[model samples]
Target chain A: MLPFARVTVIGLGLIGSSITRAVRQYMPSVRITGHDADPQVRETAVRLQLCDDVADTPGAAVIDADLVILCVPVGAMGQVAGEIADDLPADAVLSDVGSSKETVLAAVREAAPHALFVPAHPVAGTENSGPEAGFATLFQHRWCIVTAPEGTDPLAAERVCEFWRRLGAMVETMEPAHHDRVLAVTSHLPHLIAYTIVGTASDLEEVTASEVIKYSAGGFRDFTRIAASDPTMWRDVFLSNREAVLDMLQRFTEDLTSLQRAIRWGKGDELFDLFTRTRAVRRSIIDQGQDDARPDFGRAHD
Target chain B: MLPFARVTVIGLGLIGSSITRAVRQYMPSVRITGHDADPQVRETAVRLQLCDDVADTPGAAVIDADLVILCVPVGAMGQVAGEIADDLPADAVLSDVGSSKETVLAAVREAAPHALFVPAHPVAGTENSGPEAGFATLFQHRWCIVTAPEGTDPLAAERVCEFWRRLGAMVETMEPAHHDRVLAVTSHLPHLIAYTIVGTASDLEEVTASEVIKYSAGGFRDFTRIAASDPTMWRDVFLSNREAVLDMLQRFTEDLTSLQRAIRWGKGDELFDLFTRTRAVRRSIIDQGQDDARPDFGRAHD
Candidate 1:
């Protein structure tokens, strides 16, 4: 069954426009109303016919919608929620596709207190951004994490879960705090490290930027893909998920320091042990269908 | 003209077997003699017909070779070189496909002082290893950095460069020390960080191993691919390129610390700026054809 007859997606970027495309592909009868703060994005959404209607304002987007998904950056969720507060239907199931859930949950609750906020984060994305980058199959076989706080309406949470499932995502429900901590390690710290290493490589006095780019296939290129993610979205993620990200960062730094010591001291066993252990993790990921088993992450050749 | 009429490859693993296949594909007239320390690998090489002949011993492999390429762990380069020293043809252009250059150069020179030892590192590989994990086109369009020390025979260096070029690689010459320094940032340190992060994720007390593997698609999977690289090979690389790798690690740690502070202080602008700068490096990598521009590193969907 269709979870919602009318869906409003605010912030028509990669995630928003992707949702619009997915809804159209999977449930053609579901009317989509998409809105973006950037007029250019709204124009693109209209030109692409991403939704049944492209709204210029967040309020207009959700006035009659049964499901409203805020697809803006985590830092902007509160403002966007507030903008649509008066116009949102009383029984509408509010949701968001933010990277971090705790801060967004608090912001959304404060701005739309009467609305049922079923916060979610689809654990899927490419480095590309904007409405033009969206694809209907982006979320296929990926995870969608739902953060339903204590006392959440079970029916609302169930409906949100069904919605993501229809979009071809596997759904998992967790508390907002748990979701934040889990993602901090799985996503946030990885991006932070990727950005730092790319920045560090570029700033080297001995290694020319051109050299780094030329030899990046050695290993650095993978990091660059993650580092190339949208700056505004990542900045908001780091800010909104501060505590968990910091906590994970501390652990990562400690682990890295131990490795640095091992390399300095010529502890081959330590290095080998860690490298060997990590290989098993990659094997598990591939076996579980989380990633392709092909070499080089299945990167295509010329 | 063909760089060499007869080539010998010792330690017939991924790089060695790939060299064999590439020679067969590109220089069909060149006869290849292959050997490996592992008996099974030698048998497999013979079965796969990776070369014209599969020698049972390293000494036998280089006895009559016009050119000899050592393809083994960096730590084993010296031992392998020593084994072939007495059998190596006096006029053979000696070379190796080790990741690090300085130590391998010293080792090769000490083992075979009269032979022309040209150290080359092809900046190409997948996480896979062994004879079955190689392809003829692995080095195509990739950078192969050759380190020819002072007073080395110019003809020998040119021959090695032409050999790589014939196999579809672009060759650049640099001093051994300089190559180490450049690769420490561009290749070694990136591998070190990827290994460390993957290790860190698996060892986390709060996050279960399965959770990390399941959500790896988020970002952690990229690190796992690099970390899944041959443990012995990477262990040798870290130890061999100790000084340069350690230096880059220090710089990376400092940069990461700065980002950590920015996240703690909610300095969104700082995070955004660095993230934004890193994106350009990715663009340069794609433009230079060092990596594919497809989103998610062009990972194939099942």
Candidate 2:
């Protein structure tokens, strides 16, 4: 049996559109409705036929749905929840795919106190964004962290987990605050560092930008892919998850400082030891099937 | 006409083995001799038939060659140059594929001063190492920066560029010091940051190592690939290119500090603007054919 028979997906961006597509591919009998704040995106969703019905308003999208997933940026989650609060079906399970959980959970509770909310974050995405950039298999083999706080209905949380499982994600339950911290290290800090390094490389006067782009295969390009991620979403993520992100950033800065000192003092042993240990992490990531096993991410050499 | 009819490569690691394979594919008639300090690597090179001849010693490898390229770590360039000094051909164009040109240039000048030394760095490689991990197209469409000092023979420099071109790389010429600075920003700093962050993530007490690896697709895995790079080579690179790498690191740190402050102060606009600008750099890297254009480095979704 399908966990969600009629699902409404708000904010037809990458994650939102991917959910609509995945539902259609995996649970064809379930009705999919999509709504986006941007008229252009709404029009594109209709043009691309991403959903069974493209709703003109958030309220209309969730009025008859058994599940409502807010796929907007973290900063806008509360507002979107408020938009559909009045019209949402009484039995509908509210959820969100925001990167940060604690803030989103709090915002959502304040906006729709009566809704059965279950917050989740699918740990999958490409650098690309928008409706067209998403696909049905985007979440395949990826983790989906479900943060259903204390007192949340068990059935509602189980249904949320089942929905993600049907969409090809491995569901893991994490405490809201703990989820925020885990994502801070795994996602937020990486994007922040990538953005900073790419900016630094581009701003260098000694090295031409053309030269930077040309020799990027040396390592810089790996960062650019993530540095290229959607600006608004990342901006909201850093702001909403500020405390955990800042804490992780502080730790990263200390580590980086130690490395800088090692380089200055020509302490090759310290550098070598850390480099060797880090290699084992990559091995685990690949061995766990979290990444491509082939060299260079299996990027074609031809 | 070929750049050199007989080529000798010392250190049959990733870059060295790739050079032999590339030579056989692109310039089959050119004689190729290989040598490695490690007996196991030499055995692997011979077993894989990476070169026309697997010489027993560095001196024997270059004794009759028209061109000799050192593919060992930057820290070992001086020692390897001294090893081949007595047997190097008088008219041989000596060169190296070292990441840092300035140090290798000085080392070659000190040990094999009589030989024509042209320093070239092929800005390409995978995280994997050793002979079997290499391929003929590792340098295809990559940039090979040839840093030939002013006193070096013009013909020798051009030949080095041509040799890289034959191996399917686009060659550019830069001053040794400038090349060091450019690569310091583009390559060395990226690797150092990757190593540091991976170490930080793994050492975190709140998040399990397994959790970090499982959720790495969120962004951290992009780093692990480069962090998995050969430790000894990277250790040598940071030490040999100390000033440039440290200078770049300082700039990166300042930028990161500013971003960190923005995140703490909830400066979403500043974060959004920088993130947007960095996206263009990724576009340029893809436009220039320096990186794969496919989303997620063309990682298979299936």
In model 1, which runs have C-alpha deviations exceeding 4 angstroms? none
* Model 1 docking grade: high
Model 2, residue A115: displacement in angstroms? 0.6
Off by over 4 Å in 2: none
lDDT string, candidate 2, A31-134, tens digits? 99999989999999999999999989999999999999999999999999999999998999999999999999999999999999999999999999999998
Best prediction by DockQ: 2
Clashing pairs in 1: none
